[model samples]
Target: MKQIVVIGGGPAGVEAAVAAAKGHSQVTLISEGPIGGRTGWDSLLPSKVWLHAAELAGVAEHTAEGVAIGAVHVTPTEVLNRIKQVAQRWSEREAQRLQAAGVKVVHGVAAFHSPHELIVRNDDSQQTLTADAVIIATGSVPRFPPTMKPDGQRIIAPRFASHLNTLPPDMIVIGGGPTGSEFASLFSRLGVKVTWIVGAPGVLPMFDPAAGAALAAAMTAHGATIHQVDVERAERTEGGVVVTTADGATHTAAMAFLAIGRVPDLSRLNLAAAGLEVGANGQLAVDNYGRTVAGHIFVVGDAAGGPMLANRALAQAWIAGRTAAELSAPGYCPHTVVSAVYTVPEIAQVGIVSGGEGELQRVRASYTASLKAYLSDETEGWVELIYDAVNRQIRGGIAVGTHAADMLAPVALAIQTGATIADLAAVFAAYPTLSEVVFAAARAVK
Candidate 1:
């Protein structure tokens, strides 16, 4: 059996080890902390739990037929405890699954002893393991420059955002990306004053402009004060944190959050010992198959660098595992990955966009046209579908509204299968549903 070692134990690492085991290879997974890594513990799942609570509160506030519900005031410590419980449950479940699949799961700090060898050390033990091939899925950590540091109290990193014992009366979030925006939204829902500092032209700048604008408007409606200021550095004060902007302006708040971005965490890997080089920013250069310069060492997930998302990591991990184990597997293409931002009215997009170096046409439909949306009092949404006018094949689409992620899947499938606008329009969807928005957009494509 081909022996494989996977490092990091995040979604990517766990998935890679599982894939290798499925390919009939002997696999070992090494994780520095709990098996879930950041996604399972800090980022994805916890945020979803908070978002779910926010959504329930929203639904209660907008209850129709004059039904009145008490105000929802969530206790921060209890919420944080809930997040920890959920994360532990998921980590244990994943660990159990990996063990059942015949993959050895080790908790330790791992570094490359050689290209084919790993030295793992825990508090009380150390071991040396050899593998035919190694997969590095070590994920990433929040990037904080020396000029701006998190104090774990007033000024905080995204990882510690959920652990706050009490919500500050006001917050200054320094980043316009998904993390910052999600926190801003959460604070706004919980009746905290938020000053959102956006470095980009607008929120979710990488997505379709319309979606970003809609989200900004929604945030503003929820009492968030939006500012187009780029934070250069931050300093903690006696009472709070002071953030200095690029234009020499300063903003103060009871608490500050740096959701700027993330860099791969490879401090302990000792890449040089494995005949590999890391970039100045700590990112590893990898090929389309997540292979490093060293043929035997492969990198996946956030370490490989693209959109830093859990689903993308899982996909890359599967491909890397299969390739490393010398098993037949379908190659992964970066363009096919789906991006979703889970705000109140979520935004999801995939594939090539309109007016982008081809004969592409764009069509739009509003959630107001969906009977289900109207019934649910969530009619503030829209869909923009782009298709190749030459062959009528769907190229890409954006969904911004209630269940936008779910609504965008069939369009993503159409793009994947080279299905035409006509093919999607002809399909029969259940009436009074948000999915009908897709059919409307397809039919409107002239």
Candidate 2:
């Protein structure tokens, strides 16, 4: 059997090890922390739990036509406890999964002993191992500029979100990307005063402008203040944190969340010994198989550096693992992956959100046209589609409302399959469903 080594235990690394083992290869996984890594414990899972709680809080505040619910109260500590329990359960299950797949698990910090070897070390022990092929899936950490540093208290990062014992009365949110937008929306629902400073003109700028405007309107209606400017500096004071803007204005809040961006955490891997280094793009680029310049070394997920999402990482991992084991697998286009922000009246987009370098025609439909949306009191949503006018083929689409990501998924399929507008418009959508809005936009394509 081929001896394969996988470094880091994020979803990508763990999946890669399991896949390689299934291909009749002996795989050893070296992880520094729990099996779930950042996604299972720190960033994705815990954040979802908090967003769910916030959604429930909104449900308890209003009286439905046939349902009467009492006021519900939740503390940050209580949510933190819940997050911890979940992480424990998930980590244990993943460990069992790895064992079932015949993959050995090692706990340590790993570095390259040579291009074809790895040295694993911890405070108490050290070992060297040989590998026929290696997969690197080390994820990233929040990038803090010189003007802002996280103390894990007043000035915080997303990874430390579940650690807060109490919600601040007011917060200053920097960065307008998906991460920043989600946190700003979460605090707005939790009744925290949020002053969002988007370096761009609005939130979710990477998506269609209509989608961004819809989300901004929804958040503003829920008591969040939005600003379009860049932050100059963030400093912690005796009472809280003070943020200065580039426009000569100062803003203060009980907390300042630095949601700017993230940088790959590959420095400890000793890439030089592996005959690899990051390129000019600030990350190591990989091809269809997630392989770098060194044929034996594969890098996936955050280290591959496109969208720092777990689903994208999982896809890359599967391909790398199987290829390493001499198995056959088809590579997928990373652009077709869905991007969703878990805010009230969520935002999701797939394929291209903007029109550029093509003969494209855009069509739009509002949630007001959907009876299901009206019945659910969510008529403030919208959907838009972009198709090639030359061939009437479906290129891309966007959805903003209930289950926005779910609604846009079929469009992603169409783009991948080269389906035409007529193909999607012919698909059956059950009535009183949110997906009808998506179909409506597709049918409207002229």
Task: Spell out the clash pairs found in candidate 1.
Answer: none
Off by over 4 Å in 2: none
Relative to the true structure, candidate 1 reaches a TM of 0.96
For all candidates in order, the CA lDDT equals 0.85, 0.86
The 10-residue segment with the lowest total lDDT in model 2: 55-64
**Residue 59 local lDDT, model 1:** 80
lDDT of 2 by residue, 152-219 (tens): 99999889967978998899989888889889998888878999998855687777777788888888
- Overall local distance difference test of candidate 1: 0.85
Q: Any idea what lDDT model 2 has?
A: 0.86
